[model samples]
Target: MRIIAHRGASHAEPENTAAAFDAALVEGADGIELDLQLSRDGEVVVFHDATLARLGLRRARIRDHDWSDLAGLDVGRWFAGQATPHRMLRLTDVLAGWGGRTHLYLEIKHAEGRRGRDRHRELAERTAEAVRAAGLIDQVSILSFHEAALEAVHALVPTLALVRNVQRVGLLTRAAQQRAGLSALCVAVDRFGAAQRARLAALERPVYVYTCDTPAQFRRACDLDATAVISNGPAAARRWFAGQTSA
Candidate 1:
């Protein structure tokens, strides 16, 4: 199975930063997985959380701030040996720099609260526009736990691959699959089981397992026939997989 760096080799570098992405590429990762959050100004920025508390700013949300306000914020201090501070990256920046270098699995998170549902369509539209502008439609796949967001993106670009981030095996329904024109299944290592495998097989979609950081998890992914394995430590995971194969 192909090894993808989850949040770009996040175990070593700050999650979602350019530094982490660069490290992942150097480690010979097959792809990079990242999260997308829309700034107030409609810029799709690379970040995993909606709030800034984990990164040091208290009681602040990414959607509440414009790109100008969010830029230059230190995003790396929380990570070990990241005292130098790394700023957030925009989707455009990643596309311009890393596009075609490796596959990108960009996850679009659902906005908070009930009213946030309306905003998901906006995020999808902007994300679709950015990807089309980048001209890397073949190299990227948009992933999301929210079906509405996935469907919204699909409506904009029919050919772009959309992968549903499966929360549980039971949620893998035919209607959801048909609506999003899903190309694959991204299942967490915990929730994957015989039922999920059967459903995905029935749908004839490829399986991509996430956060496989342990040797046991890597072995399990192979047994489950994962097309790709996403992890925080791509370099270590690659070594473990290679060791298992050679043995």
Candidate 2:
């Protein structure tokens, strides 16, 4: 199974920061997973939450401000470390810097309760441009829980690999796979059962699990033949997987 760093070794560094991603690479993670949101000026920035309040800064919406404004905020204080202050990262920076070295899983955050046809399209256009500019269009796979957002991304870059991220396993997932032309399934490892694993296996596509920080969860992912295991601690997962492979 592949070990993907969730938010770039978040257990060690602030989530979604360049330093965190660099640490993940230094620790030899197989993949790096991150979330994307569009700024006011249509820049695709890598960040998890919509607000900056959790980072001990003002409660400002990332989408409401441009990248220049958001970049000035300290995004690292939310983590346990006292010395680290995270700078907002651009999606283009990650692709150009780390695309060839590690697998990139881009999760597009949906603008919930907001209605506009072009909003998703704008995000998709910026994401596509960045991926293409960095020559990572083939290497990176874009994913989203919202089907509409995924559709917008697919329209922008049809050849880009897409994954359907869902909470539960059911017809919705199956339908998403069919409708989105998704190449992989990313699910919560605990929600996957024998039947679901078998079903996904039969489809001949990869199945990935998210936020697997424990050894037992890693074992379950291995047993289920998961293609990728996303976790906050990539080093721990790497050691466990290496041991499994050697055993």
Candidate 3:
């Protein structure tokens, strides 16, 4: 099974920062997962939330700021023990830097309503364009909770592969998966079990579980025969897996 770093070893480093990705590699992760959002000026940036409130900037949203404005912000200051501040990265930059080092899973943040759909399409297009430009068509997978975004990506980059992050297992119908051309399905670690695993397996695609930060979650993922399990601390997960194997 592949051990992918959730937000790139995010437990020790600020999520989505280059440092976090570096840490993930050092921790022996097989792949790295990151989030993508559009900047006000039309740049595809690597960020998770719609707002900067987590960074202590209230009422400040990611889409409200231009890339130039967002690039200067110290995104790492909010994380404990992050001695150095990190800046937000653009998809162009991330692709250029980490394209072939390891597999990547790029998630488009969830959004709702008609306006959100428009934004999703734009993000999907831009993200797919960037990945194509970087020559990572075989190494990266575009993911989104919104099937529309996945559909947009499928239309733009038919061979790039797509992943759908489903909230409720039943919400992911065979037709929806077929429509998105999903290469895989991802679920929150807590939501997957033997029954759910069998149900997802019927699609005949790999199953990925996310935010597997704890040993139990990681173990459960393995038990469910996950193709890959995402976690915030790759090193710890490795140790846990090693212990299980040696026992």
Q: What is the lDDT of candidate 3?
A: 0.84
**How would you encode candidate 3's per-residue C-alpha lDDT over 172-244 as one tens digit per residue?**
6743445746788888788767777677777787888887878779778886778888889999888888888
Instruction: Go through the candidates in order and give the C-alpha RMSD of each one to the true structure.
Output: 1.6, 2.0, 1.7
Best by lDDT: 1
Predictions ranked by lDDT, top down?
1, 3, 2
As a TM-score, model 2 comes out at 0.91
Cα TM-score of candidate 1: 0.94
Tens digits of per-residue lDDT for model 1, 1-247 = 7999999988888999999999999998999999998888888899889899987788899989999988989988788776687998999999998989999988998888565877778888888889998899999999998888888889998888998887676776743455746888888887775545555667777888987998778876876678889999999998998897799
Structural similarity to truth (TM-score) of each candidate? 0.94, 0.91, 0.94
TM-score: the better of candidates 2 and 3: 3
Q: Once model 3 is optimally superposed onto the true structure by TM-score, how far is the C-alpha of residue 220 displaced, in angstroms?
A: 1.6
In terms of lDDT, which candidate is stronger, 1 or 3? 1
Candidate 2 structure lDDT:
0.80
Q: Candidate 1: which stretches are off by over 4 Å?
A: 174-176, 194-196
